[model samples]
Target: MATNITWHPNLTYQERSELINQKGATIWLTGLSASGKSTIACALEQLLLKEKVTAYRLDGDNIRFGLNKDLGFSEKDRVENIRRIAEVSKLFADSCSIAVTSFISPYREDRDKARELHLNSNLKFIEVFVDVPLEVAEKRDPKGLYKKAREGVIKDFTGISAPYEAPIKPEIHIRTDLLSVEESALQIYNYLKEHNVL
Candidate 1:
């Protein structure tokens, strides 16, 4: 099945970047649920667009409604879900667009695989650790997921029934518990700018 595939592209990533006037990259935001990953990502997207940058967000829930609709919360399914998102993000990066992904990609191995994918492609992969205490996340419970998990309505939930392996040396670490949405987004935006990804 792989033998018949052929590469066909008229414009290179550099050309695309030249046309867009910005470099392409992937910003992988990982943390426990309600850790403000999505909130910060959305705000960052808006900021990037306001600066005339091409950016797109591949959020966890949004992907589940489409590309990952068939996947579930099982460990195996979760790995595949992140795998697919990482691949898609690479494609977006190859086209010179910023791919912002927000997911509770709890496993270190899984997140490492996504980083490897981007690194091998010569695309910037930023691992952002949206750090928030489990207690705080449960207290916030923006989606009521923590409540459901506590009631046994949901199983294999990260920071509850499942596990979340925090990044050892993330490119950026945002303590959402101590920062506002704008501040968190600005931290990420500053990272992209300092790294020449914007």
Candidate 2:
């Protein structure tokens, strides 16, 4: 069944980029739950829009409500969830739009696979690690997920029952426990500018 698909596109990636007046890229924000990934992503989107950049954000919960609605919190499902998001993000990047993805994609291999996908396509893949202590994240549990996980209402919760392997050398690392949301977003924006991704 897979072999039945054929590759075809009307416009070249470069043409799409030229028309948009900006290059395509994927900015993947990963960390534990309540680690400020979504907040920073939101700010980053606003910042990019102010500069007239075509940026789109694919957040975890929002995507689960739609594209990944059937996926659960099991390890296998989590991997599949990220895989689907990565493919969609690549599509956005191919179209000359910046794709900002915020996910607690807790495993190193999973995150690396996403990066490899973009690299294979010659697209920019920026991995931004939102660093925060587990205690800090629990304290700022805006969605009350940590409390639920602690009560056994949730299973395979990253940083609780599950594991979150920190990135060894991500493109950007923001310590949310030390930095404000605006500061974190600006740091990512600066990275895009310095790397000529903007």
Candidate 3:
């Protein structure tokens, strides 16, 4: 909205990586609610931190309470919520820190847009599909959101009232319904390692 402002350029990405001792990337975890995205993202962050890798997690509900407080669950709001998070994560990656985002970004278009943003900036964008059956996610709903959706207390709920489009070619696919949280986290860590993103 501030069109008067011009872009400012400073250090190059490689220069920032040198200063921070590591390159940065965005680990985008998307799935249906309660598909273990947050749990796996938390574990991944912990694992990376333990290995001396600087990392941060951008959680959906947490961001809603803060940066996206004005947004709601409507389709337009959801799109904006994801767009804002993608921008924030891009900034984090530019700063040479891993940005782990755990959101049920249900639409493929939104997810693709996020990926395009990172790719355009020459930053690594690792799309991680935290996959589980709808029934499994509903059954393991720790926050009872699925229950609320089922009871008609919630609107535009993913995997119920709304749709959840699975990633067609995510860099990493996690079957959380079959894998433990630790395993899922380690799987991603291994991917980052193999891809030289960590």
Candidate 4:
């Protein structure tokens, strides 16, 4: 921690939303590898943008290339990565833009911490569990991560080596195998509409 550190107050969330005609929230998509988190997130962002809603995607691999470059897949590093993501998503929500985050955030504790951060800030934290069976995920492994994990080439892989703590009561539980990408995005969009996230 730094000495003499203090938070400078800025425009209120309501004020910003009034000016921008948009209220911000975070739709956090969590699941195992190949569970369609990123794909659904991408579709949701596109749909929101087309409807004139300000939205941005914070992809796991993309964030690792930049904002979280120093972080690795270790348990400690993963925790820190989520902490940073929570902070960044809060900033976006405060700026009156939806933060669509796609990550295989396997730990319940870390996800709960992120939810707490948004709750404290008076922002919406929509937990979307893109759930798929382990066998289904392995079959759909676009990155071959499941195969690598099975071969012992990848360590600490969720649903393979590491554990994925499924959400007990996620706001949205999407079954990608049952729904198309468009339908999945529509489901989230409908949730936002119903919850008055506009």
Candidate 5:
């Protein structure tokens, strides 16, 4: 005999939201490789921690080296990469955790698809565009990814061989070229404060 699945309604999101003293959300940072997305994300997480908030960061390099090791930079692989991260972010948000994900996520369609997976009123999926000119990003090649892509050593890289479509209207746009790391973090924190998420 097959066992029937049981249904159970445990704690409500409102209960959890009240307990945390804040709402659940995911900060999605999308930009070129050297556009300072990760830097700002890390800084923001530290600031949140100081304010007694729980924050988790998922960096592109860290994820690519592990969760997406088998994946290449092809369009399909890029979709899969962002899809996995989005699902993970949704899980974190559902658990009332602040999830910050830094990725290129070059395609608008792919990013929107990811957002659809967690289309909840409580889930504030903020898309932060780290705006840095291509020339500036190339100059700040901390990992030399730009040079490699230009030399054809790395194929399908965003903002180089591949395209990186900036968000038409991002929830937050941090101009990395103009703002210092601390300033960018403050901008993000102010946004969170304005939304009453922190």
Candidate 6:
């Protein structure tokens, strides 16, 4: 048997934004692990919350352990992982929440597919690249992921065994190597305000 679902064409994003007193946007934070994407995202969330803005975070590690547990690091699996996250973020945006997603998402095509899936013409998909050298990421190795990758214990590790395609024209590129967590978050927050997403 198949389940039937009802669809309702309700208010638009603009309408919802007006009612919420804030704009809706998908802040896609992409970079290697330990590149400070999640750190900055968390800080940004706190700042937004202080200002009473609705916000939600979609973390990659947390997601992989659940919704994408069956998936691997293969190209196809990676794409699917991001696809699911993007759809989830779109739902959050529809609820007038600022959806912030932090993922390695090394492939440009995978990231582009997310933009297509959401179908929001005015959807602010801010690509915040956590610019950090591969050596630095390995040195920091907050989770020992890099150590495992280097020892061949981990496969498809971005910037080690896997490829990471840097965005040529990301909306905002924050160098974690240079900016403190608070500074990076502030810069992103300011960008959201400039684009009317907060």
Give candidates' CA RMSD values in order: 1.2, 1.0, 0.8, 0.7, 2.9, 2.1
Give the worst 10-residue stretch by lDDT in candidate 6: 116-125
Order the numbered candidates by lDDT, best leading: 4, 3, 2, 1, 5, 6
**lDDT of candidate 5?**
0.88
lDDT string for model 1 (1-198, tens) is: 599889986987778878867788999999999999999999999999999888999997679999999999999999999999999999988888999999999999999999999999889999999999989998999889999999999999899899889999999999998999999999999988888787
RMSD of 2: 1.0
Misplaced by over 4 Å in model 4 are none
TM-score of 3: 0.98
How close is every model to the real structure, measured as TM-score? 0.96, 0.97, 0.98, 0.98, 0.91, 0.92
For all candidates, the clash counts are: 0, 0, 0, 0, 0, 0
Error of 5 at 190 (Å): 0.3
Task: For model 1, give the 10-residue run with minimal summed lDDT.
Answer: 12-21
Error of 5 at 196 (Å): 1.2
Q: Compared with the true structure, what per-residue lDDT tens digits does model 3 show for residues 161-192?
A: 99989999999999998899999999999998
Clashing pairs in 4: none
Expressed as tens digits, the lDDT of each residue in 18-53 for candidate 2 is 876889999999999999999999999999999999
Worst ten in a row by lDDT for model 5: 114-123
lDDT of 6 at 142: 86
Global lDDT scores for all candidate models = 0.92, 0.94, 0.94, 0.94, 0.88, 0.86
Q: What's the CA error at residue 120 for candidate 4, in Å?
A: 0.4
- Clashing residue pairs in candidate 5 (N, C-alpha, C atoms within 3 angstroms): none
Model 6, 43-75: lDDT tens digits are 998998899998988896678888889999899
Off by over 4 Å in 6: 1-6, 119-121
Error of 3 at 130 (Å): 0.5
